[model samples]
Target: MTSRFERGVTYAILALFTVTSLTPVLGILSTAFGRQSSLDTGFSLPDGLNWGNFADAWSRAHFGTYLMNSVLVTAAVVTATCVLAVLAAYAFAVMRFPGSTVLFYLFLAGLTLPQEALIVPLYFDLRHWGLTDTYWALILPQTAQSLAFAVFWMRAYFRGSPRAVIEAARIDGASSWTTLWRILVPMGRPAISTMVVIVFMWTWNEFLLALVMVSDEAHRTVPLGLAFFQGQHSSDTVLLAAASVLIALPVVIVYVLLQRRFIEGMLSGATKE
Candidate 1:
């Protein structure tokens, strides 16, 4: 009974904290639906609806092009990174081979390197290869950067997965590819969904790669485009909020949709066999 009481108290505290955290986000959401003058006094509900704010911001910021570029780059990075990371992580977690530990550690070492440290060299390397100002520039670097963490994330889950189940799949005549895709992949959803959410969020919000590697306005991702948008609409708080909401909506939506898997992945380590 005491433990149950304690659990109830804990949940109440967490619920309060969640509401507190979301207050700022709710404020910004309300701002997105109002006018610039609405903010001068304090936070409040829009007198009515102001859908034009979104239209104006979208039109003025040329967010259509920016959104397209973001979608393309993020989609490429997420797909390539997931495929490569899952393959590499499965080998690390399941296979026995020469120097696996060393290779794994080398991949892990990439986690320590900062993007700022690599940008200058990366810029030069891309320029030398004439890949600068191209979608490949954004796609490739983000994919590479994301792969390190994705491998790490997937490796933990894969290592914890049921060894008996894996053996059964192999004994049932499943090839390596068949076993991985047909058996282990379905069981690893929580981890995969978590990785997808993280990679999508990171790739969507990435600024430095877009700023340095993409020169053309047509190639600008939403975040970089938002920077220019902010510069132009510095005084229009309503428009800025709306623009931010538009840029951020996809990430929020993705998280909301995959939230169950994300939470499960986070809590999945303790029951490992």
Candidate 2:
């Protein structure tokens, strides 16, 4: 059992880390709400809540179009990645066939390759294929990129699943597809939810991929839009802060909604192999 002194130290350390992490966010919030004229007062609370900052930022930045593009791209990437990863992971975990080990290792190789290394060739390939400046440019590449980690994550969970449960399902004369979809998938809700949150955040915040793959304004994601917005409004701290908040709000909302499952998945040993 943990000692009282040890528990107290742990809580104190966690509290310090929490405040450290939140300090920058609080500073941004203060600047977002502060009067435009008070830009010189660094990190101080606003005299009054300036709600119009968000409205003005939204209008000036054209976030609606960018946000919608991000939503479409993120949703597509997450859905595709999850479906493909689950199928691939289930096969690796439960099925055996010729060259399965080699194939699985090849998938794991993707995790070692960084996006920067492939961006140039990938751009040329996408351009050659006439996919540049399109949603497919964003969605397809990101889905493929995310699949590496997604497969790795879900495979561990599937491998750690109870053997008795899998045997019982097999004894029921269930097909592999039925066992995966009905029994394993439902049982791994926490792990899947955790993967969703991670992949959503990654896809939503992806900037370099968007920049290299897409040049059309219609295909720009939030991070790309925010970069241009920042360039144009470099001096407008209030609007910048507000726009930053807007860009981050969706990710924050998603994590908040899935916080419990994410934590549960992380803390649980079900992913151990």
Residue 257 lDDT in model 2? 97
Residue-by-residue lDDT tens digits, candidate 1, 1-273: 479889999999999999999888888778888865665422688886789989999999999999999999999999999999999999999988999999999999989999999999999999999999999999999999999999998888788889998899889988889888998888888889889999999999999999999989989999999999889888888999899989999998999999998888778741245
**What lDDT would candidate 1 get against the real structure?**
0.90
List, residue by residue over 150-201, the lDDT tens digit for candidate 2.
9989999999998888899999999999999998998898899999999999
Question: Can you tell me which runs of candidate 1 are displaced by over 4 Å?
Answer: 1-12, 36-42, 270-273
Error of 1 at 176 (Å): 1.6
Candidate with best lDDT: 2
In order, the Cα lDDT scores of the candidates are 0.90, 0.92
Global fold similarity of model 2 (TM-score)? 0.97
**Which residue pairs clash within candidate 2?**
none
lDDT for 273 (candidate 2): 30
| Lowest lDDT block of 10, candidate 1 | 34-43
Q: What is the TM-score of each candidate against the true structure?
A: 0.93, 0.97
